[model samples]
Target: MTMQASEKTPRQKRGIAKTVAFVVILMTVFVAGFFYKILQPRVMNAVELRANGAIVFDNPRIIEAFELSDHRGEAFTLENFKGKWSLVFFGFTHCPDICPITLAKLAQVYPKLESDIAKQTQVIMVSVDPARDTQEKLAAYVPYFHQDFIGVSGDFLQTMQLTQNLNVAFRKVVQGDDYTVDHSGNIVVINPNGHYHAFIKPPFELARLLTVYQSMVQSF
Candidate 1:
């Protein structure tokens, strides 16, 4: 009977050890998957960093080319904007709130530009949702912000290519068979040579942006 009990003790120990090993493996897999799900978007964002600096335009992507048209029936290429500073914003005219707010603040900064500086600084608005923001609508909307502001758009293929090159992430969200574009809320500044100038991320401080604009204009 003592020998039988000894054999039973080994069997019980082996069963308990196997159970603990299985639980550990399950927990490790669960934790690894949880971490992956939490960090995926951040990893993708790291791959899309654009220019960042206080005075100069930080490193901007120069890898892609775009062909688009302006609101007033003029052909606007990346080439046409050469030799002037452009405050290029990406949004549709149909954007009811945020777009107008940004433009209004930009308007506040507009007249402050000195004449020589003003001529060099062109306010440009590019629509990420081109299917809806037509030339006429854009023409009307742009002037409400600043009389001289220019609005531009193109077909989906061309728009996507340009936005991607600029590192602007946008998605067309579909619901009940209709769709709306979910896009980033930031402005890109293109320099006189048609290279990137800088970017202004929002919650914008009007005083700071105006100051930055003045400095950049002086540099140009």
Candidate 2:
């Protein structure tokens, strides 16, 4: 009987320890879940921003001074990007598919934006094929989609200055003595401070783009 009681006491201590461990683990999960619920709105907002193609940067990149000419022959410099938000696309007039489609979708999206946002925002298309896409060509091409949309182009070096800083990639491809400019289709967003803020990935959906853009501007 003495031996049996000693064994039972050990078993009881083991049982108590197991209960204490289970209680600690259960409380840890419960505390974690309570904090998660409290933070859900901010967490979900960030997730929704990414899901909608609004890839915001943790730190905005500063844009250096670069010189290019706008469709109106005005000096389009880094200063042009200040004082308002700019949506910039890199493509050429000869882009047979993506450029035109993206510009058309932007045209549709622009007018539907809230009045305050539309007033403060500007749309710009920078030519990747400066050798073939002249100011006259851009002037005629860019405004066809939207009158307010600005087209920018310059010498190869000047174009490179902006494209390199923005991380926009482009190259000239030759086919049968003619050439085409292959370029990225992502739309770059510049904040009012002339800093690189975010980018929207291509195959852009009009509704999603509008929603995401509005959310970014409002949040800023």
Candidate 3:
């Protein structure tokens, strides 16, 4: 009877181990299903955010670390784009035509946006010609279009870090006494996560911009 009882004890222990393993597998499946159900809607929304004409990246490109000073002399970094949608343009304060025209068009769209939208969206002009576009000059030039507009300038290498990441091109076209930077005329959209989201090409229309921007923000 002692031998039989000892043999039964080992079988009972094996049965308990099997039950525990089964329970763990069941729990893992249940937890995975719960999370999948919770995340399905968000995954769908991201997919629906895709625009037709705008060049939005499928695999969002992460921006590198860069530090610059805003027109107000406040430090600006990759952190500034966090929790805020940003429209960035790389142009000089001394840009003859393209910069002013682009900024003017942007100004037209600024006030027309809903107060909530305006608060969440920021327009930044990053100077390609940092030598001449000082913080003082940026403060004067940026606000001329809109009071809320921001202008940033710092070391050329730091500025280039951002420009290159965004694929914005700019080169100095030196003439005898004056030089102008020939830059790409496209506005880059940065998502609240500080990732490169989209690029809007030139001849921007106010109504079209507002429509697309609102859609992008909502979907994002």
Candidate 4:
């Protein structure tokens, strides 16, 4: 009886050890899954941004100080870009199709932003054709799309200063008896630090734009 009891005692101890090990593994898996569930949305946002044609810079570019005038005739400098997010588009009021369409799309997206984001965001139209896009012209045009939209224009050299640094290209093409300005259609995103963070390309979709903008802002 003593020999049988000794063998049973050893078997019971081994069974309890196995059960403890299993419990520990189960607890570990549960903790891991809990954390993953919490982190999954952020990971998916980055993926969605890429899928939506947003080009996020690994290292954001610094914007140099350039003086310009807003539609309200206020001085708009690098400081104006500070402390808030700026969505900048380079176009003229005279643009036949692209400018109006793009601005309308932005207008549609602006009101849909979360209140926090809307408060921190500003939509700006920087005139690529400064010769014809005086402050008054911009004032009348930009606000037609959204009441809060800002129109910016300055001397050609000053405009070039901002555009070249931001990698925006614009040129005048002489048509019969007139000229048209051809410019890049991408929307430039400036971070709260007044740095060039990313650009969202053309063929913009309202949902995709909202997603990309929100993801970038929230991640920042």
Best by TM-score: 4
Q: Clash totals for all models, in order?
A: 0, 0, 0, 0
Provide the TM-score for each candidate, comma-separated.
0.70, 0.79, 0.75, 0.80
Report residue 195 deviation for candidate 1 (angstroms).
0.4
Candidate 2 Cα errors over 4 Å, as ranges: 1-44
The residue-by-residue lDDT of candidate 4 on 1-220, one tens digit each, is: 3656456687788997899999999999999999988854342265667778898888999999999999999999999999999999999999999999999999999998888999999999999999999888999999999999999999999999999999999999999999999899999999999999999998989977887888899888
After the best TM-score superposition of candidate 3, give how far the Cα of residue 134 lies from its true spot, in angstroms.
0.5
lDDT of 3 by residue, 1-220 (tens): 3556456687788997899999999999999999988853222233333443356677778999899999999999999988999999889888889999999999998887767878899999999999999999999999999998999999999988889999998888989988878899988999989999988777687766766666667666
- For all candidates in order, the CA lDDT equals 0.75, 0.90, 0.85, 0.92
Worst 10 residues of 2 by lDDT: 38-47
| Positional deviation of residue 50's Cα in model 2 after best superposition, in angstroms | 1.1
Ranking, TM-score, top scorer first: 4, 2, 3, 1
Model 1: lDDT of residue 158: 90
1-220 per-residue lDDT for model 1 (tens digits): 3556456687788997899999999999999999988853221121122222242544654635678999998888878668888887888876767788888888988887666778778888889889998899898998888888889998989988877777777887886877777787777777777777566677656766665666665644
By lDDT, the better pick of 2 and 3 is: 2
lDDT of 3: 0.85
Where in model 3 is the C-alpha error above 4 Å? 1-53
